[model samples]
Target: MTEPAGETPIFERIGGAATVDRLVDRFYDRMDSLPEASGIRAMHAPDLGPVREVLKRYLGEWLGGPPLYSAERGHPRLRQRHLHIPIGAAERDAWLLCMQGALEETVADPQLRAGIYDAMARLADWMRNIPEDGRDQAAP
Candidate 1:
């Protein structure tokens, strides 16, 4: 997508790699502490170090920074990669909750933060593999 000024990327607007790091760290911190995030947290390994790095790389590239994540691991195929996990409406909401908090804590610009959150919410929603209640969800 095109960014403002057609020059600065979202990555640079948000403070580049440093901000990405803080965002991911704060995200995990929230997932680890927020009671609402317990379900999603249970999906992760006891040691979050590896996943932390993976997310950092993923976000870095996603935000228009570097291509580290793609260079190491081809196309993200996010949904396919997470097909094994059972994410429903509640789980998606929980993940968004942690991400929202992290974005609020790390991003200074309100509009920029909201934009990022909107995109993330869409991605998180797409990762849901299980259906909630009476809704029918297509498998990945």
Candidate 2:
């Protein structure tokens, strides 16, 4: 399907479904193997397969390829969906670290990589539910 006003979607620019698949695979691989990511990685199920598929679909739709994610799972209330997990500065940083590596490994275009990383950094920061000082916001 054509994107509105003839602008090519980021998904197409970034090489479509194949690239998206590779990106997600690398992202999870880093999370699974990086010592610095252990804390955040522990938040995931022992088997990464399911989450990997979810991310691929979510990212594909987010990058404007197809609405596969929302079509199957409805709205992606990401923050709400992650509320059960406690995220702070460290968690956000770790997540970004994995994402940065994945982007560098998958996206050859520097400008496109920077844009995607910046947006992802914002999303990661927004997912933080705990303060940098380690205080839980949900606590009194």
The residue ranges of model 2 lying beyond 4 angstroms of the native Cα positions read: 1-5, 133-140
Model 1 TM-score on a 0 to 1 scale:
0.92
Q: Pick the candidate with the highest TM-score.
A: 1
Name the regions of candidate 1 deviating beyond 4 angstroms: 1-5, 133-140
Q: Backbone clash tally for model 2? A: 0
Q: Provide TM-scores for the models.
A: 0.92, 0.91
Predicted candidate 1 versus true structure: per-residue lDDT over 29-135, tens digit per residue: 99999999999999999999999999999999999998999999999998889888888899999999999999999999999999999989888887777877556
The per-candidate count of clashes, in order, stands at: 0, 0
lDDT of each: 0.91, 0.91
